[model samples]
Target: MGRHSPAPAPSAAASAAAAAAASSASTPPPRGGRAPRDADADSPSAAELRGLLEDGDGGAAPGGGRELSYLQAVNFAGGLLLPLRLPSAHAIHKRPSAAYLEAGTLLGEEAGRLLKLAGPLFIEGITNIGAQLVATTTVSRLGAGPLALSALVLAQTQLNFGYSIVCGIAAAMETCAGQAFGARHYALLGLILQCAMALCLLFAVPTAALWASGAMAPLLVRLGQLPDVAAAAGSLLQLMWPVLPLLVVSETTGQYLLAQGVAAPASVAGLTSLACAVPAYWWLVGRLGWLRGAPAAQVSLQAIAAVVVVAWRSARDARVARTEPHRATWRGWSFEALRGLPTYARYAVPAAAMLCAEWWIWEAVVFLAGLLPSRAEVQLGALGFVMQVSIATWTLSYSIGTGAATRIANALGAGHASNARRIFVLACCLLAVANSAVAATLWCLRHRLSAALTPDPEIGAEVRRILPAAILGVVGDGQVAVLGGLLRAAGRQSTGALIHFCTYWLFGLPAGVLLGFVFEWGALGLWMGVASATALQAVALHAWVALGLDWQREVRRSAATVGALLGSTGATPTPAAAPARSFAIAGLEEDGLTEEEEDGDEEGGGGGAGAGAGSALTSPAGAGGGSGLTSPLLGGRG
Candidate 1:
């Protein structure tokens, strides 16, 4: 996966052919001696030639000379002009019904589309979390000792921290692979999937080593944890070491399929795993009295998920090869996967930081609960219960967010800026409605839910006391999740990381500490502080999207991102022109010129025709014209 060499310059014959075609198309025939009607009929019109250029058709021209492919013409013209000279908003609106579609009709259509994608995702998220919930419950049934419960919490926290990194890498894949699939750049999807899997597996090495080394127990003890609890946590962590690689495979492969709009396999697999896990946990832990059973059952669940997803992938490939062979995504392993490492890291690092920032803040709050002056164990139990409820509710938002990101990425990749903007708007609306309903339902059932979760009156009472604040936090968290999706779709994870760091670390954590410790507000105050920060975070993200986002710019950036991946893998026939069609069709569709309008504009040598030609000649391969060359290929909005 060494750095790709630059695309070769066009051949002299191809260059001459392109020059001849451009001259023939642009220059007018002599007025004094018009060609006969028959001859005129045989010769291609200026509009026809333009169509050839736009469509990348491969055929002989008027003079029996070979015509350049669309990409070849782009490369011949120059590389930097194509992406910069996009159509204006007026032109975009000119497409039939593009601006005329009824708002209700559009919203209804988009809502259905979003729900289609989000449904399977929601099911998968719930089932995945359910498996973990079953493990936790089984562990609880072991006894009332704080040592086992505390150790399980500690071990699970550590596992989640590492797993979040894997998830971040998978999220990057959602951006890259989804856009590539949307852009009809099918070859790039396989390569991106491979890169994600490799990176995740590579990451698992050090994480697994740390878990297996038994260092966490001593570290936790030094950090003021009881020695017995830390030792039990360490042992549990060792038991969980093998699950890391399985998780990497499961998460990465599941995301790969999800990027392509194939979610049923993962959802079904999750359901099966959950069904198997509950019974396994009961048999191993409840009946057999094995402390290691909880971790063992978790490992089995992940293994099932990984295997099922891989099997589905293989079957999908076989089916695609037999039916739509040309559209097949996988092309076997290659060094090309290595070439994409830098690009993967460009998104993955910030995505990891963004998720870790939020996760660590919650973990910090949990630790804060442990530091209470009295009734620390009860407080910890209550906080844990509230956290689980919050996470379960968050699954709804996560599903919606993931669906939004997928749609936006696909729309931008296909050069549909208006559609992408619509998706963002619709996703926000859906998030609001869904979260509002969830908040109301939870508010009504807060007491019953708390009682169902635990038998301890003290823990149940504490949970009920904090439920209102946690519910508010869930609403804010839902908004933040969807906004984060917008950022991810646009490859703006670095910005997301900054937002999380500021909101969680600078504001949320500090506020929680001050209120929980200094003011002695306990768990309720800590949750209130987090809820306030979440609301602030959501507001900030909303303002950024409303004021700062440029959909047209994102469309161009998506082209570059996909183009860079295609170039790195050598999958595109003409690396230089890979991104050209992405925006070329966009410009054409946005301009909304009918055949007659095109002819009239060409005769006048102005308006839409001139703009289209100028756009092509000046901005080849979706590269922006003029000053756009100054922008880096992979650069995106911050």
Candidate 2:
């Protein structure tokens, strides 16, 4: 291989001209004076990428293979389970030396952006989980015996699934919001979020009725829960009504803020409220009664914090709108926004299914573990303890995953397909790094951490016994958590959902039962089976994505998705040919040639919120993450 001189990088002007040239060549002009919607079918970036891959610049040892090898996936899995010692999927392995330099630079940029977003996400997850820990501990102290403790644990575990389901429904906003923000179609971001909020609230009515009214555990009772445990748990759940709607609100709103790369206030609010809830737990439960509305206040604060952050950002955005004419706010969108609900649901339903199905797989393990004969009681306790620890560590992965999806969406929206691909691999690297640390730490402190998670020495000992399985399981959990998000960004939510169903529901669960009950390995065996399934799931997903997924195609798909969403409700700008074909239409204002020209009326000011009255929003350094009624997400577990 003679090292002839490297190809010089194209300038900004040359890049734009190449893109315009490629767009013209790839797609034809629309008919009858219509605007072009698919003009960028083969964008300049995409065309260049195709050529690069052909020359074997696809990160496979420069001239080796174009795609990520099976070996890379194995290394990635190993890295996650084992940490820095193993290699993770990386673009550097695919490109030539000059390309390698560019790939490495992009990897760092993506990593930094990912950490920026994931940091708050982890904080939110911690605080949210911490709040639940506080509430659970308080309930366990009720002096109502081990039965009371058991009931609350069971009740919460069930509620966690419900919470995940609703948030799953809201996850649609991540894709819509991420793409819209990236393409600078700022108004669509607000509209998509509003639609998500409305949709989630509709789902929440039944959820609130069940959780707030204390009906969740009763549903479990009818399914075969012990009457006493069900009754006690239902009573605990009954006091949680105030948190239901707030949960959906905080989640949907946070999704909106994160897409715009704003995270600090919500993070601060969630972490602060959760931190406060710890002390509040002692005072509220000790004096105000058990399962009382005291902890709900923290949940409420978290929800309020989420709203406050959005509002704050909205207002700042509004002010910017007043000055920056390029920030195009759509005028008179109530009718359009209202009509888009069904359109939004089209995306949201599957998005929700993907997230919920995976989360419930964990819940299913708990339910099945209860079938064990004499050891069912302590076994459930041991399982729940380890599962929560795994879930808690998953916060980091979830945050990173969310950031990965958002950043991938943004790059794709901007028509940077190559960057999107680079970032995706980098995200996997980051995920492997984070999960490796989790595996290493859990492995190191099994004795101490296990004892700390429970009061009963026997249960603690059981936790230690199964700690290795939990450590291994989280390696996969963390991988899928991020991969799942990227899949959504790639317009493959259904595929991700299907993969998860097969992995956890069809395969993992069956393996667990076979190993646990049939093989008599008990809880440890069940966990080992599940852990194996997680690894398989991650490997399978990595393999499928590496071989089949195309970043350039995904970029085009994202554009079509947002364009179609906009057109469905007559929200597409007049003379939409350029927008339909061009990734960044170069112009959005009606009369002005550029975005800096202000609209005649202030009513059209804040473009990010669409036709709704402008809400204040701004980008700030975020401080944290959150999940369920007792979730460990945004403020505290709402």
Candidate 3:
């Protein structure tokens, strides 16, 4: 209600839609000697009869808007339902085995880093802000019935946090699928999909169970300990289930595109959903006045039309992608797809948990805020705005992080350590420069920004007080962002996940609450927690990057844990472990072979993972690769 991060700027689909309109022939040629009647075609005869119907409506009533041409119509339709179209198109265009893993690896690495640091922090801000908005708007507009709104916000917050994990899993799927495509392991892609499906199915149960176990209102009341809050949360949670499948589909589709270097649809989906959902929310609850119980029902019913159009188009596209079904290799549900399940699940589950941990950190902060005075409500709202602003900008970090992850993984898998190092340097430089700019802007705007959110001077004051610390968190947030993406990309997701859990949950949230409420620092204290946690995570993420992830351990754990699941589900058994090859951080130890031998081996059957690690004292490639090293390298102090 009060606003958060300007709803992330109209998304790729919206932009495309607008572009199609502007570029295409705005008007249609005469049809029936006047205009084409396309919008209400019942059938072929019915279509012909449409002329009669139009005539019945008094002289062909000039077809409201010009009918779009085939291309224009397709583009327009795509924009209208871009989320389903773009993602589905990607899956169709690149079958699992046909994708490029190196590219995916690069993207995944970057994505992992961005996700680890910035991603979670970004969402925390979003959910916190969302809670604040619901609180503030409800108080502003419907003081008497604000409790229902609060409940809705709490429920929404939980669902919102939960949805981020769905996004992560989707990314994991996209990354692996992309990699398998590159490696020409077509079956691997199927395996990844199979495992992802199994994992998604597996995850849905636990997450749903957790939602149910929370007892909805009681959980909210206990966390916030507010009676009105509890009631609102319960009602909201009850309605949340219907949205789960939608969330999963949306996230998976978006991630699939990211793997293919397509950002528009995912971005568009986010923008469209926020823009559409927010207003739709007002219409269902505020205008229609369905406050007594289950706002989700009203929401689900309203969304049906949009869903139908999108789904119908998606189904059609999927069908079109496969002209003829492959012979049933093994009957009912191809067990062969199960081959990659263990591998994907191994990476995905922790990746999902890592994502969940990051989200929970902010959720904890909001929980802490609930314990404070109602004035804290305004503070939380203000925090949300700051966070959204940060995240919208953070998208750039996600792009870079995804790139790094893909590059690092690809180089490593292909045995190119130097390239991986160079890529890492590039990511840090880009992220740092971008973060600095955001910080400067925040500093300049802090004063004027707070007053805009509310009429109350007290709320404004609290926001300004917390603004500096919050901005500091934003900077640290960027570092963590790339680091997390890099880790996931490099197959070091567990390390990143551990760092997140420790920093946010173990340290940050608690510290913020204690300082804010216990010490009477108020909103500023809450932000202090954010700064502290982010700083801690930034240090750890960088450290892990400097000292590479224990891939051996990761691979082993992934294999062991995922193996059983895959076996039970009829997926392939684990492949034999390769001989461990170790190198210093710079990827130095060569396997000693002639150039011809190297080339031959590279193309031969004796394939292996990425280059050995070591710091290369080699000159930077065009100097872009080493743009941000401030201190002296090789152990010298600046």
Candidate 4:
């Protein structure tokens, strides 16, 4: 009766218009601006992210304020809201006390992750240093005079450059493998590992020729070395020819293993080989070309140990070897791997440059010390002693950064941008804390350091004079070194390389020359230059990461980078061959097995995370994209 009296029934068109108005009214507008486009809305602010995570469903109320189940929420909320950029610890703590507490706990998780990643690396690093120490001490026992010692240092510097090149190239495997695991591109991880090894073998040829022909020594002579010293250096380098390929193989295999998540074995291999180095040195010290053979044997032992461990570990894990028929990417040795060389060079070249720039700056300083008065041998020997000691301790902080990079890369590949930021923050904080403790310990021992390194009072005195500043420089470099790892993880190797070029090459080296020589400040002056460069570099990297790093963009870029390599390496399976994200190729599914299967394949085969287990192979990119990491200077820290 009321309806008949109110008015004639509304027309269909009027009813439709009224219904539209009611629907629009049901959903409120955002408090400020219009809703962002899909791409823009994909990465939301922290508060918006909180909304998406806090509810029982752990999802946002899309359509302004409507909650839905997880599946429907995607349509309602227009996909997950990810916080990409990690401003800094200061900014995160400044938000509120509650957030600060949460941030602190998150930071702890970050630290824990970094430790898990870096602990093996740290042990590996120490083992490596121990090997070097043993070799050097053995050489000293052979009664090489200061001239021979000087020659050895120069040879070591040149050989280190070659090592960097090979390690640099192998590092591409880290990026591709990590992303492949994350994107569920398991076959691609194997292909990348193989391709990288092939490239290293090829590159070693030219490196061998250069070392054998004495080309590396002329540069030392030009740098003001005595002619006799240069010749001795050339002889030492010539003896090291057998080691280049060995080093490349070891590094490539280890990197491959680590990306797959088998970290403990790599550490074990490193330690076992390190322990054997002394015996190798003793056995070979009396042989012809013994100067070269000792180190060759030592590194060869290490390389063989790493590769063998990976093989044995993979065999032990049944799930990892379920499908051995498809192990080879192309059935044999193929240069198709060479297709990825240029792409790798983009990352490796910069990384090599960065490490070389930092390393050579110091080496160059050592040579300049020769230009000083009549104490050239004493000064050069003293400088070498300091550098070796510094290297032994410097790796502590670098391991932290390396772990951070690995975790960040794995997170990005898994499409978790927040986890990546958490890793970045944790890395920075861990480096600060770790380096602080290391710096303090080193500083406290400054007086005894020189006496321990060299026997000569004059040389010891020179090292003593410079030890304080040199240790301090270690702290500063530690900060920059780890941040450099972050850039590598983010696939911004060029940025890190550029910073190194500017700070170490252009500014730091030149300043070191002017100060140490022209100003007569000596070794102390050189370290001061390094300190200055480290400060600038740390500031630059920190600013870039905190203010300019667009992690969402990096996520896309990383995916593209890894995808390009997978395609080039011929690892992508055909559409009809299997499901896109299926674990068929790595043998995750085989022989009528039920859905339940052992996790050996998922942990898979590799070095860094317990022979390749990080749950990295989670989901396919789904026509989407990610990045992973193998550090340029990180592993190839010559």
In the range 1-638, model 2's lDDT, one tens digit per residue, is: 01122323433333444465566556655574332322222223445444434534223242133322211222223212211111222432433333334434434544665677777777877877777777667766753667766776766666676678778878877777776655556667667776787888887778767766766666878988888888877776676655667777677777776666666555776766776776676676677665554445445555666666667556756775687545434232365576678767767888888887777776677777888865888988898888888778888888888777876776555444544665667788877877898789888888889878888988887888888877877767777877887787766777877887887778888899898999887888788777887898899988987766655456556566566556555454322112211111211100111121111122211111111111111111111000001111121000
**Winner of 3 and 4 under TM-score:** 4
Give residue 241's lDDT in candidate 2 (0 to 100): 56
1-638 per-residue lDDT for model 3 (tens digits): 00122222332333433454344335565573422222111112334223322322232212211111111222232211111101111132222222233233434443343333334334433443443354346433633475655655566677776676765676565345433222222223344554565556566667766665647667666654578677756655665665555555444543433332223343333334444444555555565444432454334532552353345335433542464232111123466556556556656867777788877767667666656775767777666655555555555566556655644443333223333454566567667887889889978987887777556786667677777877776667767767776666555556667778888877887898789888888767877886798888888777765564433222222222222333334533212222222211011122221222122112101111221121111121101111111222221000
lDDT of 4 by residue, 433-503 (tens): 77788789888887777667777889889888777777777667677867876676666766777788898
Residue 522 in model 4: lDDT: 76
lDDT on C-alpha atoms for all candidate structures: 0.68, 0.60, 0.47, 0.58
Per-residue CA lDDT of model 1 for 238-268, tens digit only, reads 8889899998888888877766666677677
Model 1 Cα shift for residue 56 (angstroms):
41
Maximum-lDDT candidate:
1
Please give the lDDT score at residue 524 for candidate 3: 72
The model with the greatest TM-score is 1
Give the least accurate 10-residue stretch of model 3, judged by summed lDDT: 620-629
Could you estimate the TM-score for every candidate? 0.76, 0.73, 0.59, 0.73
Better candidate number, 1 or 4, judged by TM-score: 1
- What would you estimate as the lDDT of candidate 1? 0.68
Please state the error at residue 504 of candidate 2 in Å. Answer: 1.0
What local lDDT does model 4 show for residue 493?
Answer: 69
* Candidate 2 wrongly placed segments (more than 4 Å): 1-106, 211-218, 293-304, 328-333, 454-457, 572-638
